[model samples]
Target: MGQLQLEEELGKGNYGTVKRVLHKPTNVYMAMKEIRLELDEAKLNGIIMELDILHRAAAPEIVDFYGAFFIESCVYYCMEHMDAGSMDKLEAEGVPEDVLGRIAGAMVRGLKFLKDEMQIIHRDVKPTNVLVNTKGQVKLCDFGVSGQLEKSLAKTNIGCQSYMAPERIKGESTGNLGTYTVSSDVWSLGLAMIEMGLGHYPYPPETYANVFAQLTAIVHGDAPELPEERFSESARDFVSRCLHKLPGSRATYAQLLSHPYLVEDRNRDVDMVGWVKRALESRAEKQVQQQRERNQQVLEQQQQGYQP
Candidate 1:
């Protein structure tokens, strides 16, 4: 790639700071993820692993990789710009069932490809890692914590705690970190689905004061499920199948693809573009309101500080 014109900063992630960039010659917009290798020796391996997976995962359901450039102290990679942004950036008012179904189907397909073709496990499968485009295409991104399966299980205890399966959390409490199977990913899928559906974390971390209590709740309490009366039976059942506490009982990616909820959504005429546009618009409005409230508070504080 030639000289690129940098746009606004996208956001910082575990690996690096992502920024919007324009490829000068091609006039193409790309999300440039810049990773500083000088920060940590382990980052070198993490960057390499992510690059390998991104380079190999050429499926439409996965984020497209453009290229990477490594300087003396850092590496910068360009990837497809997701205009609709991540699923987490959408309005917190909750996602439509149809849109959720679309995202779920796409994510499962991407995960299945990683598992079946490469025997890789996405150790982290949270809402923030799922990306959507204006074209209504949903894809999975960020392979930082992804790892190859060892004896049908991943041993690393990396990833979001709230989305962790009961076995993983319980194992963490003990000396051992539980072996991660594909079903562990399925548990994350259920959590991600519920999070996007409710527009918030299903198990809100702030509600619990003690960290041990939070882990205990995840390990001992009943697994999270969708609101039965609020959602369709098929939708509720699909989430139930994914949230099974016993990893073996959880539905595989293949089984998830065949779920009635996803199947029905697939057959219908969906207006995903409209749904996403509306959500983004709402989010923008909410952000402006929040900014105004912050400014108001600042003015009020200044007024109180004035000496009579």
Candidate 2:
């Protein structure tokens, strides 16, 4: 902790905040995740689990962990700083197919590594949790909600409800809890792919009257598919296998890796470096526009106050 210098905050969530940090000795930039300690046993367990996973998860598709230490009431862990930030921060114009395929391959390989090597389930797989860098590398992060698989099933329903699989939703609705399998995460991967390709969530709650209605639809309605007009046949087929109605029918990680879409992508060259640069530029422009709008609103409010 003493060797690290804190910089601007990267993001915040329910568990803690991630910040850009610098190691004084090495002069290397890193992302530091700071989690405040709580008295609850469950919260402590989660923190420990995340630390354990980060320490052991060493792969090209996963973020590189540095070191961790306890400072007062908080635990600070350092990881590789992804300069480009999360995929969710990109513009909503949608990612190019080639870039999308590359991103999908990286995510699938990362998840597969976690499952096969670490015996863990990501539990949360979304654009926000997937980070990218200027080097065009895509890696997974934020493992606070991740859990170890017990006999191929993780019996906890702790993840984003919007990305939950149909079977998981049904279990919650009927009060007949069922074990969560790796297939559930595969379903989430499919939904995330659609969001990245279309620039929005496939199942928008605004279309329904209420939250219950949305969940009902997810549990009983036909699974969403990629639009044929925009996506290739191989891409659509791959996603269809993932978004299968039944959990048992969803494609396994190994199967997905062997799919023609991924196989083709492995051989193709994608300009992810250019895409990431453009995405970051777009994000900066959007932030500037938002700031201008805020300033205008403030000026109008001041004028109204002076008019009296």
Candidate 3:
């Protein structure tokens, strides 16, 4: 523990919390996820699945793994550190369609690799799990919930509820309940693309009183689309393809990669490094401004002899 110098806490989830850590001997920086080994099936599955995939999968679209070991009740594993962080932290304003298309292309390629080579389905495919680096690299991370296909179907719902497809939400009332297909991942991809496009969740979570209401809207409501005025026709069509109500109608990874929306920008010379740099700078400046305001308020309160 002492040799692994801890840095800022990246994020935490149901299974584990990821931290930026440095190995003193080699001075290597990596993202280490410290997961508590609870004697439960879900947690056990997550730990085993993540470690298995991370160790075997080697692609530009996937995060690189260093190693993993168990210490006491927690299992700590190291992997790539995405310097620019995840898509959730990126600036949404002025993020044009081309940039988004590039991200989608990379993600699709990553998902394709998992599907074709590893026979795995990433149950969770949200913005937070898609990591981006300052070098213009966008790779998929967090594979704990990923599942191997058995006859092209995984019968479990171990993913984010808000990003679940209508079939996933229903569970099994429709006969295929608990049965999941790759199309379910497509639905999640559409939602993630919108979140990156709009800087927030596509679904109106606030309007709904509860999770069920939000899910009901997802199941029964019309599919979401990017505003015509804000996005191009190709973009709108592409999202529609992924968010189809019927899983069979949804575009597969190969089809989506061939879609004009993604292919058009695949080779375009987008200054991703510059875009990510600017976004990080903007976030840092905003944080500084917020801190300044807070300090000023504190100083004023002290001068006025305010008591709490």
Candidate 4:
């Protein structure tokens, strides 16, 4: 809009592109998500749903929503710009146990707020949806696929397939994907925690021959857990409570907050700001290295062409 100046593109996904922008009047930096409108009703509904949730979700652990506007065919909504970026980008070398516990606590509190206050379930609970800043605050974002709990269950199987729980995957395979409880999100949280702690997805699809094989493994194989060698007993126990194959046995948001791992985290001082700074520096270095490799490859190709 007239009051905002676009700075740079933050990220792009299937639905839209997010860009860094500055609000002229307020002189504040914000991340603006621009979703192009199409004739598809479902897509429009998703946009509307996200806006609705953003406007209503006012919690410390959730991203702060600014304002939204419609221009031409695109709908742009602004939110708090998390300078440090998402957790997925920072987990390359794996997160420390103390830092992980703090991050997990924020995520659980945010998800709990959505369910209890807004009557919504964050269908997509992954590292990428969790954002952090220099202030050491971790918040949840990207609620486009979030669903309303109907009779303690959400009937839709819409979310990142890789992060889907075993029971949810089984439901999809059998064509009996009627409904999944909130505990499904707990499974995702557990998986995401392991991924953050290990610096990669716990169930790497590359290990399997195909997508079906991977899904089958998730449905039938043992639930993944944090390695005992790397993480403490309390941390492992918290994750185990989340990765339970049976949804009924999984820990609730309240229980997760009360867990000894998180309880201990409350007393300990974790250096999230230092961690984020180092992670960003590492990411920048990796990008530079990748660019150098690409340039070298192009130069080699050029030399080969010249020889002929």
Q: Highest lDDT: which candidate? A: 4
lDDT of 3: 0.80
Error of 4 at 134 (Å): 1.5
lDDT of 2 at 149: 22
RMSD of each: 3.5, 3.4, 4.0, 3.4
Candidate 1 on 1-308: residue-level lDDT in tens? 35899999988874469999999988999999886655455756666776886788888788998989887887888999998899889838778777788888988999999888867778778887899888888988875433321112134332234677887666554646556678988999999999898888877767777666776777778877777666788888999999988889999999999989888988988888898888888889999999999999999999999957
**Winner by TM-score between candidate 3 and candidate 2:** 2
User: 296 in model 3: Cα distance from truth in Å?
Assistant: 4.8
> What lDDT does candidate 1 reach at residue 204?
72
Q: Give the clash count for each candidate.
A: 0, 0, 2, 0
- Candidate 1's displacement at residue 218, Å, is 1.0
Model-by-model lDDT, in order? 0.80, 0.83, 0.80, 0.85
Ranking by lDDT: 4, 2, 3, 1
Better of 2 and 4 by lDDT: 4
Which stretches of model 4 miss by more than 4 angstroms?
Answer: 39-50, 144-161, 173-177
**Worst window of 10 by summed lDDT in candidate 1:** 145-154
What's model 1's TM-score? 0.90
Q: Candidate 4: lDDT of 173?
A: 57
The TM-score between candidate 3 and the true structure equals 0.88
C-alpha displacement of 252 in model 2, angstroms? Answer: 0.9
